[model samples]
Target: MKISSRFTVAVHVLSLISLNKNVVSTSEWIAESVNTNPVVIRRVMGKLKKAGLLDIRRGLGGATLQRNLADITLLDVYKAVEVVEDGELFQMHENPNPNCPVGANIQDVLELILFRAQDAMEVVLKEITMEELVKVLSKKIG
Candidate 1:
């Protein structure tokens, strides 16, 4: 029921890139900012690149955004690194008690609720762009 931290890390990496748009973002520097290993940052960067959210260069080079911050959304980042099965953002428990009416019915009810919740979440995430995040961070740092 837990989402991987890859999504957050990807966002953090992208944010760093956005903030330092004039300069290439090295994995080492991004890793330092994320408090993670360079290898981890590289892995997430691969995903972002594949998603067309980033442009990565070879050795001695670094990463950059493929598009403006306003063009990217958290859901785009989520889809890039999320490893969920069946493409579901949420999962339901397996094997609800068939004999129990409540247990049997609960799964269906939960599915509907969880689906709606995920939809609502994506809607909000869609509303938020990387531009908004960078602005917020810039204000805090300055």
Candidate 2:
């Protein structure tokens, strides 16, 4: 299964806020850009706020970035949105037959490989800051 869309939506929200600093980025406005419901934007914003990545205002005050784009890595957004449980990106099938040799051993052997793969993906994400992504996005928009 693919990672949750929450991660990408969070990235989109932050990018929009950073790029459009002059405008007050309400949930509705961001939702329009993301083509989703305002509730979805609100939910994602709440997670980002809890992670110290965003400062969400009450009522019409709208939201703002708590940290600079350069300071926030893609991994930060990924974790803030909680796309997956910690070290549990790739879940093994439940109730594999313990009586069968391969079934019993499969999870044990595969867990490490999956963890390594997730770690590698995280490393790449950590290296790419939101600033780097917004720069590319800005270039495309222009």
lDDT against the true structure, per candidate, is 0.86, 0.94
Error of 2 at 71 (Å): 1.2
Task: State how far residue 138 of model 1 sits from its true place (Å).
Answer: 0.9
Compose the digit string of candidate 1's lDDT tens values, residues 37-88: 9999999999889989999989767998898889998778888886554566
Which candidate gets the maximum TM-score versus the true structure? Answer: 2
Best by lDDT: 2
- TM-score of each model, in listed order: 0.84, 0.91
**Alpha carbon lDDT at 4, candidate 1:** 83
Cα misplacement distance, residue 82 of candidate 2 (Å): 1.5
- The residue-level lDDT of candidate 2 at 14 comes to 97
RMSD of 2: 1.5
lDDT of 2: 0.94
Clashing pairs in 1: none
Which stretches in model 2 have alpha-carbon errors above 4 Å?
A: none
